[model samples]
Target: MELRTLGYFVAVADAGSVSAAAAVVHVTQPAISRQLRQLETELGLELFTRGPGRLSLTAAGQQFLPHARDVLHRADEARAAARTYAAGRLERLTIAAPTTTLTDVIAPFLATLTDDDPMPTVFESDPREAYPALRHGADLAIVTEAPRSTLAARALASLPVWAYVRDDHPWHGRDAVALHELVDETVLALTPSFRPRQILDTALARLGVPLDRVVDCSNPQVAQALAAAGRGVAVVTDDARFGLWPVQIVGRDGPLRIDLFAAWEPEHHAAETLAALAARLGEFCVERYGPDVAPAGHVGQMGREY
Candidate 1:
């Protein structure tokens, strides 16, 4: 089927009704409905179940949804690639990143770009989804851990994890606390999808230290807020600006750390620009978090030929 038909199908799937889809696609309701009918006929499948107020996807439609989206994404990428090549230079850069990196790393790095430089677009997503968006078309993705992909990556920083407590709390003023020491404490944690939460969960599981209560948060700021309100012990990276007392999470060797990376497709036309951005990001992290947190030998390490 035509790519426009796939776009119509995806809009209907997202909107759940023809009238809504028409509004989104900037077409008349009858036009969208006719297109949907033709698409179903061409595929020889009933893609949707008609109803008075809303529409729902059929089993066949559910199976087809992801592929339709992929087709639309690739089509858009092809158009962008062609335009970039015709222009003989990159015109814009799209970077996907987790929220933490957006706040701590990317925002500052973006300020350093010259006005004539290609304007950067930032898409905030979960760390797990960021790299996929990059692979799909985003020029770069900054994530907390190494992604399981063939994309070229440059390590940026490695931040030590800490347990934050209110000044009035009993754990305040402590230099460090072993994993077992937190067994009976209610812990404020980032959501399980985040790399830090995964590491904390695995370490606690291995140490046989069952957390009394786990308060899940979306970002470090929220976790720190909860800790300051005496809700629970917030597990976070070292941030002196938050004003919370931080206790190092001592592991068998030493403090727990999480490495962050800037990743991009190796063959991207803007590889040199991406490498420059990665180096700038590394420097920004070092300036904000200190040299200890900056990954060793990360400078000038991007865009290595794969």
Candidate 2:
């Protein structure tokens, strides 16, 4: 099928109706509708079901959605690669990653860059949005999960998730606190959007530990601030702040951890160079954080939650 037809199909699916898709695609409603019909006929599958003023994907269409998106992404990658080829070399790169990663990890890494390295830009997004960020525009995605088999993904580091408390707090000088131990304490936590919070919630549910008093904040720094004020114990992956001591969060089997991964399209014109860049970044993380720091203050764990 034509790439244009696939584009129209995707547009319709995203916009939820033919007319809306037509507006997005800058085409007449009848033209786009005709294109969809022809696309379905060519594939021998009904892609969508009509409703009052909406269209929903059929079962087959649901299964095909990722494949369609992959094709479109590959096309975009090809165009980008071709442009890079025409330019003889890559000039810049964009990295997509979570806010803490950008702030604590990447910012320092950027300072170590040489004058010869491609100029880099950062996009703030969660690990779950890594691949989508790449499909949209980013050259690399730093995520908590290893990417799909199709893309090149390199494990960077598994960083520590700590329960931070001020010097005067009871747990401040302690080696570490068991996840179940948080049950009795007033706990400060980040929202579910962060991997540490997600890991904490899962471990709490699995361990049957219900925290009596929990304060959820959207920002890790804010969580730390609240903990420093004696409000609660802040559990986050960020570095120590507000003169607070960091304690490794011990889960049932091990410590709570956020695994970092760097991903990129393997077929890009500068794929090899990107792999080298990923390698450099991974090396830097290992050098800075060590392989598995899960033992005490800055430790790591084998079993990952995020």
Candidate 3:
């Protein structure tokens, strides 16, 4: 079966119709329809059931869908491997991470690199999407959530989530604040997609701390600015800004923090090199963040989103 044919099949499955898949794949509807029929002929099973405008996957199709996706993912990894070796060793490095982690953690680590090291191309993704970015094209992915089982992954570090306030604010000199204390004050939080917000939300719910004066911002910098303006206490994993100081958020268990993880496909052509690079990254995170930032031991497991 053609890889293109498989791609079209997956597209059709996602789009719900051959015509709709054609639009996304940028091919004519008749060509897609013909290919789908040929695919069915080769497999000796009907993959879809015809309907008025939409198509539903057949029982066989439903079973085949996951295998098809796996095949496509493997094919993509193969191409990525070929491209990396064909281009030259360490020449095809691309890292994907959440915007805040990309800026705060990865960027700082990259700055410490010498000219001998491979300079990676970086892409900003949501905390959840960071791992999936590897399946798309990224050579390495940094995420707060656990990596998929198929990918080789390692825990980088545990970075503390912070509550930020102006230098003159009453809590600025404090080392840490209780999670329940947030309920009494206006809190500036990032959207749920960010690791800090996820950590905050989970902790608050567990402690039964219902915060009513929470202001949501899409950007951590904005959250810091709002806090500096005395709007609310900024809860984020970002570095302190706007002349603010970071106070560790104390949860019921311990200091509220997010675990950092680096993930990549172990079957990639430069798998060894990628693994080495991820190790170097983990090392740098430890060195830069200081000894207080503990190294995490979780690797290759179905762990929590935080």
lDDT of each: 0.81, 0.84, 0.84
For candidate 3, lDDT tens digit of each residue in 71-144? 99999999987876875467657998888888888888888777777777888887667666777889888878
What 10-residue stretch in candidate 1 is worst by lDDT? 297-306
Candidate 2 C-alpha error for residue 48, in Å = 58
What TM-score should be assigned to candidate 3?
0.68
lDDT tens digits by residue: candidate 1, 87-201: 5456788989877678767787788788877888998978778767976879988877765457777888888788898888888898888988777788989988788888888
Candidate 3: residue 221 lDDT (0-100): 92
Better of 1 and 2 by TM-score: 2
Give the Cα error of residue 280 in candidate 2, in Å.
1.2
Q: Is candidate 1 or 3 superior in lDDT?
A: 3
Is candidate 1 or 3 superior in TM-score? 3
RMSDs, each prediction? 13.4, 15.2, 14.6
Winning model by TM-score: 3
